[model samples]
Target: MAANFSNSLVRWIDHRLPVFSYLRHAAYDYPTPKNLNYWWNFGSLAGISLAIMIVSGIALAMNYTPHVNHAFDSVERIMRDVNYGWLIRYIHMNGASFFFIVVYIHIFRGVYFGSYKSPRELLWILGVIILLLMMATAFMGYVLPWGQMSFWGATVITNLFSAVPLIGESLVTWLWGGFSIDNPTLNRFFVLHYLFPFIIVSIVLLHIVALHRFGSNNPLGIDIKYPNDTIPFHPYYTIKDAYGLGVFLILFAGVVFFAPNFFGEPDNYIPSNPLSTPLHIVPEWYFLPFYAILRSIPDKLGGVISMFGSIVVLLLLPWLDRSPVRSGHFRGVFKIFFGILLIDIVALGYLGGKPSRGMYVIFSRLATAYYFAYFLVILPVLSKFDSSRLLPKSISTPMPEVNGIE
Candidate 1:
């Protein structure tokens, strides 16, 4: 009787609002490629990470003070005094790193499989926009604690705007809401930090809608040609994603419980002291590659442009690679280049964390050069000549069994 009543209620709502029908079509009945692999799991993982961040952030904000004088103490109070505050703070702190890790993997998977090609160009662009927004939101949130790194890091990064031609200083002043980083800056950062996540959520929804329109690209990178090439997203991919989430949560829990400060800088433990600058100042790990690029160039304005251009290049990727083939799996030489590109990026990230001196500068310059060349020169040139292997007819095509499993 209860089940029948529930079914009837759902039917009544579906007849008017259709929310149930919409969810059923979008989540359960959506057609997904049958050949998707573990790499695809990162997309769903990123969504879950976003949800965790939002929930934990709100909880932390309830006890956080945005004023510079009290911000540091408030964070400490939450860590020591508030109920389950330590757990919430740790989860929120480490969740940022986990979120970036998932999103980066998702991006690389897209690039590797040509998920950015053809009909999905806008989808790729939207993803890049989300990345930019995430960067901004993270930067703002980092300042909320009002620690040593938070203050100086904010000072240095906001000063980068001074490289703009005419309105640079004005823009910086406006950003700070004063001549320098002070109470106004902290308040502004706090408000924006609280606000940007919701903006990110909105973009995420649009991203989902965009993704569902074209369906997901698979490991094979071939277009679906038959009913057998696809499976319902519910029982198949949903179960696969949940399994991935379980593994991810284990790693995340280990970090949160065992080494909550793994990604944090020790300098941030100290309160902000404008009079005493630390020996070394650096942004978060996720921002390192771009930071390296920013410092690589000698000219301040040039460095700023190069750093921003690095992201702009991603927006142009759909057009930059004029290749007919979508997947790196089918492109032999391109695969080798892609491997080198990944190594170069990792090297840049490592160098970003190091002092901008001696061998670090040299390597950063080389990596930065290769980064642009890979997209602007190499991809365009290779697109004209690189030959791809013959692709499978459809996602349902059978392959020879490996290790005699079949």
Candidate 2:
């Protein structure tokens, strides 16, 4: 049986793209850091999460209708008629939240450990692109329900691009494919939402490929520096990533089964009516900080531009953080800035849930200012003034490079 399977696989490989050699390099023979903890598992874990999303989303789509009138009802029908449809829907829904959670942790792990430093910059940039795609996909998913929040949220969000100068109104029309976000908008969002994940999958593959070229950064932000520090991707990282994946799955299953709708908005249960808006049109929790930024300014265009600027600023972090040091462990000023950024994100989240009013608006501006300050003022200043402890150079130093080819 083993011989037959191997023969078939070899034949198939001969007929298709060259994959075994790359797999051999990346998984079996490739060297990696033996010191790497479970945190490093997130890259693989993220790939798995994406796969789960695509599979579940495709299944859900089998029953989904694109029309506004029947879209919500069709979802309900899927819930009621399709066997285990509820389970499927909940898995996809909570899976999105879970996906974001892991990705955020992944991003932070990269940031905290200086995974975005030279050689890894492309991978990190790819990560930023992935994050943007995820936000767009999630927003489109929200709109699919055509729920009250979905309706108003679409209106409010789509209108933000109108903050542009001459092209503003035209851009809105282009986005809508018409006068407003009606049937055409829903149709495009549905198509693009379905399509974008495939693009993300490709990007993620590129991200890993880039990561393989550089090897991963360690928790200490030190070079592999020695022979014993690294190990092969298969035995070392495979085990670590599997363990993390098991733990993540437990959390995922918990959300799917117990608190399925807990992260979702209650108002989404109601269908969209343009004339009627939800009491509050808050986006998902993951989007809270940006939402806060969007409502911070009285000037529509300024508020819109600032909200986008926050994300654009994240992309420039590799260029911005000129600190000789990598880890927050050693950089005093960088540590403080990291703390401030965390607090600012929380404050922005709070503002997102509140009414766009006196205190909320003021605090939103404050938090928004702090948000930009972290990457712009804080990071740049720290990189300039923060003194870092020196250490051994290269992955093959005192800390021996592991399984990777030297």
Point to the candidate with the largest lDDT. Answer: 1
Task: Report the lDDT tens digits of candidate 1 across residue range 18-42.
Answer: 7787778877668898889899999
Q: Write the per-residue lDDT of candidate 2 for residues 1-406, one digit (tens) a residue.
A: 1222256777577446556655667785567877677777787788899999999999999999999889999999988999999998999988898888889889888877778878678888999999999999999998998889887888989998888999999999999999988999999999999999999999988998898887888866776656666778887677778888899999889888989999999998888888887777899999998999988978999988898888888789899888767766566556667877878888998899899998888899999988888888878877887544444465455533322224
Pick out the ten consecutive residues of candidate 2 with the lowest summed lDDT: 397-406
| Best candidate (score: TM-score) | 1
For candidate 2, the TM-score is: 0.92
Instruction: Tell me the deviation in Å of residue 282 in model 2.
Output: 0.7
Residue 142, model 1: lDDT of 93
Clashes of each: 0, 21
User: What's the distance in Å from true for residue 276, model 1?
Assistant: 0.6
Q: Global CA lDDT of candidate 1, please?
A: 0.91
